[model samples]
Target: MQEHSHLDVGDADPPPGTARPGGRTARNREAVLDAALGLLAEHGYAATCVQDIATRSGVAASTIYRRWGNRDGVILDLAGTLVAEPVGALPDTGDLERDLTLLGRVILDVMSNPRDGVVQSTLVAAGVHSPTARRTLAQIINRRVEDTKIIAERAVERGDVPADTDAGKVINTLAAPIYHRWYILGEEPTDDELAGFARVAAHAARDALLT
Candidate 1:
């Protein structure tokens, strides 16, 4: 998301007579990323390759290589885009339960989407072989945590939670069960279950009852 600004390198600034650097670079990125995502959705991770993406997107493999470094980089960027949430902009309904439920639903919606789910599953498969994929996934999770941390901070400021409350823990607790259901158990949770998850997590955080 906006959590990793460094990963979102836009087009370069214009120097002399050149048009916007982002014009072609940005177009190429969009095309390549779209192609990659479509392939991941249709054929899955292992079957998709740079050459296939290049052919589908009408871009060069060298360009994709130069821009993204490898397939892992491309998938990482795709994952980031799929799950991009604005930093520090979590829902504020003045009630911790509603806010946490909103956050949990957002997470579930993102992870359970068809394309996003395929991307995540592919990343997990890649992680078995590539240390870089594993690290990138961890960084993505950290970024998500950072983005959601503001919710807990606001709850603390509103006297809903302790100043020493662990934001990461709270967020992770809210997310873990949903993630387990989808990613580990390969089960799709109903809306009521998602709402219950949010309510429990918020209640736990509010009472400081969770260890």
Candidate 2:
């Protein structure tokens, strides 16, 4: 496979070579990450190289290796930063159904994004071939699970869901279908489809656990 060139970071020049230490470091890191993400999206994992990332980021290959170790390290860092941003906090509209519908919409919006799709595809491929990749991906997802647990706990506290509701299952059900459709079947979930999943999932949880 031929290696692709790095992403152009546009004409916005980095600060002069002698600028403040903190700002320069931040800019370089962001540039590297942005370029890496772009390249990963464009070329997938196999064709991307450290030299490409450095060229795309306008940094030195030595600098990238020093900073991120290797290609896997760069991707791990990217996944960490990307997943760290919390999606909007779980909705609490006083109605469990309505709140879940909102959550479904948010999830649909996230999964349908092309950038997210690229990241998912790269990670999935990596997980199949690299133990480190699999573990890193697991960590990223575990954090998301923790976030969902908090939402589930809040729902129980508000009497929107039963205390014994399997929060993990509830959360997984909401996302699994969409993920399957997108990543497994290569089909994006429609808004109506997402709404239906949310409705059915919420109803099942209610009937089974909430009496």
Candidate 3:
């Protein structure tokens, strides 16, 4: 029988190199992170605990606490979960409207998927009090924003958008509603709704409304 015991994770920082340990240590780390992500997707943030992760991973609860310190460290350490990609990137379609619509669809897919949703939700949950979580999430968003710069630059070059239009602003505007509905309102929007928002952002950009 699995223990439904709540977490006993410490608030201290985990040991250095916890994710890169050697031999069986590495194996335990891998097992623990995998279990954490699976459980988080299945049960959500409030329902999951270190005991649950340990039971699922076949690792000891105490060992998990020692290695990760808390749920924050565990979720934030999950493999490739938070790895960022170039945001706002669409194939060169020679049309800003089409590119942004595609970008919005991509964001919608990520937020709507069960596994990906949980990974992001878990990060947001952990970011509340965890510096590591906050930093990691910020870094991922920053990278995405940086990557999207090319899209804005191209739009400027084509004169489809205002000169020196801010890429970060455009992507953020498009993403704001989707994220709000998902995380704040606890609702998943329809594909049409997601695409609509992206389309609106693109329209706004071309009309210089986002300026």
Instruction: Output the better candidate (1/2) by TM-score.
Output: 1
- Report the lDDT of model 1 for residue 82: 45
Q: Give the distance in Å from residue 166's predicted Cα in candidate 2 to where it truly belongs.
A: 2.7
Per-residue lDDT for 119-168 in model 2, tens only?
A: 65677788988887787777766667667666566667887677788877
Candidate 1, residues 89-192, lDDT tens digits: the string is: 57889887788888887777767566656676787778788887777667767788888878777888898887677888888888899888887898977878
Per residue, candidate 3 scores C-alpha lDDT tens digits across 9-69 of 2222335654533556766776776777678767788888999999988999998888778
lDDT of 3 at 134: 69
| Alpha-carbon runs more than 4 Å astray in model 2 | 1-26, 114-117, 209-211
Identify the leading candidate in terms of TM-score: 1
Judging by lDDT against the true structure, name the best candidate: 1
TM-score of each: 0.78, 0.77, 0.76
Show where candidate 3 strays beyond 4 Å.
1-22, 79-81, 84-91, 126-135, 209-211
Task: State the displacement of the C-alpha of residue 69, model 3, in Å, after optimal TM-score superposition.
Answer: 1.1
Task: Candidate 1: count the clashes.
Answer: 0
User: By lDDT, highest first, what's the ranking?
Assistant: 1, 2, 3
lDDT agreement of model 1 with the native: 0.75
Off by over 4 Å in 1: 1-9, 12-20, 23-26, 65-70, 80-89, 114-116, 209-211
Candidate 3's TM-score: 0.76
Select the stronger candidate by TM-score from 2 and 3: 2
